[model samples]
Target: MFFSVVENKSMVNQSGKTGKQLKMTSYLAQEVRLARRHEEILSQRSVLLQQMETYLGDKKTKKTWQTQAADAAHKRNAALLNDIEAAEKKLQERVYLLPHPDTVKLETLYWASVEESLPKWEEFLLGRAETPIGFKKMKSAKWNISYPEEDSQK
Candidate 1:
């Protein structure tokens, strides 16, 4: 999931940075670096995929890419693909710059009030009191995704 503070997008696209946007520039720089790395990995993975496709399409060239070699290459390609996907996912999470000082204070207070009030009304409003269970399930569901080895290391 991607999250960003307000005014972040305009700051990112602007060439000339004002005092408030300097932090955003640095955040954009980090995102750019990650994006480049993601693209490079994707290109490398694409080549491997194309090679596998070629091997699959042409049966006459069996000696060129043997069965065992193709299987090994397929494993390598799968690993590379996983890496590419991970990188792409990382690219989605960016460092968002906070808005101006006064705006921040105002928003903070507003959200604090919302949080303070939410719990009291949460049950009545959040429950599917009138709606069907199936409809609510279709609208929202909990998700859990695992990266076994990678998550263990972290």
Candidate 2:
């Protein structure tokens, strides 16, 4: 009896205009499925973009973002070198002649006289009798050594 009832139910479900309605409903289901697929792709793209943004926002990546950092460092180095060179030029420009008047005038009265200037001048030019004039002597034989004969023989 139950089997007969189930067969009757199936017969009615397959009958009349419901078959055409079912076909239309299946078409709508396919459309909905396609729309859902598009939504899933868009959602995945959004998630990927968010992940990329987060990666770009990291401190190290943000700070050292490009090869231009090396260029900027090189520019800074060049500017600093130019500044150092300019400062050295200014220092060289102000360098005065030897017997730098300010230093010698304050230390000695030798520059004051007019007539008896020869001996003080010689002493000043030739250095004191105690310390001979010329290049400093090597503390040890750690450097090349050479001595020229006295100019009187030449």
Candidate 3:
């Protein structure tokens, strides 16, 4: 798994699964919200349809107009509902060791990249020993750290 020491930055840990569950939870929440929005829009359209039917009633005209509006609303509703179902399917397909969304604080969007690279990270380390690297194998490496620029910079 991986972790972040600050906001909007993430580093993969041993298995690159650090914020995986949190990332999934965030994505699922987004899908669910979109689904709910669709449901709300459908509800609103239904209400408008009923109102129009009541207003345009002249017996024969009532049947024709109501049918048209209902048909359109039905199609749109079906599409929106399908989106919800697809989102749910994705949510169900995934499995994570630590599925805690409660822990997400600073790094919200950053974890998305971390989750994306997790499988590759695991594959990369597959040939290595199961246990962590021994001190004997340690080596020094160069580093180039970045910093946020101040507004005072022209």
Candidate 4:
């Protein structure tokens, strides 16, 4: 006796055993690559935005900064000019105050005359034997060292 069994082709089930698994892995790898590329592009854009913001911030302050600098320079120049004018005026005043030798000699002679001609009554009234004579008081006291004609000639 001989026996035979015929197999049915429809009895096999794939259930994603081999070929589908390879395809899914390949798709996951492609997705990861795309995600990394997008992250790199977003980072570059953020860096460019920060640089543009810095440039724009400086542009907004341009006019006021230049005006302040010009004002400071003008003030410095004016102060320097005032200091130079003051120094020139001081030099001129010093030159005017300098006493000539002839004027000093005449002044000495006038004071000597007043010292010699002091009366006893005037000395007693003032309570001091001698007093320092200034130029203003000497002129008012009729003390003269030169002739009227000679002074008029000068």
Top candidate on TM-score is 4
Task: Write model 2 residue lDDT over 26-106, tens digit each, in one string.
Answer: 879998999999999999999999988888787557577555788898899999999999999887776643557767886
Question: What range of 10 consecutive residues in model 3 has the weakest lDDT sum?
Answer: 129-138
| Residue pairs with backbone overlap in model 2 | none
State how far residue 30 of model 2 sits from its true place (Å).
0.6
| TM-score (C-alpha, index-matched) for candidate 3 | 0.27
What lDDT does the true structure give each of the candidates? Answer: 0.73, 0.69, 0.70, 0.71
**Most accurate candidate by lDDT:** 1
The C-alpha TM-scores of every prediction are 0.25, 0.33, 0.27, 0.37
Q: Please give, for residues 1-154, the per-residue lDDT of candidate 1 as tens digits.
A: 2335555545454566543477656889999999999999999999999998997778746665697798999999999999999987776553234466889899999999889866665665888354433334443334555769989899
As for candidate 3, its clashing pairs are 1-13, 1-15, 1-17, 1-18, 2-13, 2-18
lDDT of 1 at 131: 45
Residue-wise C-alpha lDDT for candidate 4, range 1-154, written one tens digit per residue: 1112222223233663344444556878988998999899899899989988887777767767888889999999999999999999998998789777899899999988867755533664587655534323356457646788998999
Model 1 stretches with alpha carbons more than 4 Å out: 1-20, 58-154
Better of 1 and 4 by lDDT: 1
> Tens digit of lDDT per residue, candidate 3, span 44-147?
99999998877767666878988999999999999999999998877776535445676554366569867876665665479643433322433444354445
User: Which rank order by TM-score, best down to worst?
Assistant: 4, 2, 3, 1
CA shift of 68, model 4, Å: 2.0
Model 1 score (lDDT): 0.73
Error of 4 at 141 (Å): 38
- Stretch of 10 with least lDDT, candidate 2: 1-10
How well does candidate 1 score on lDDT at residue 151? Answer: 90
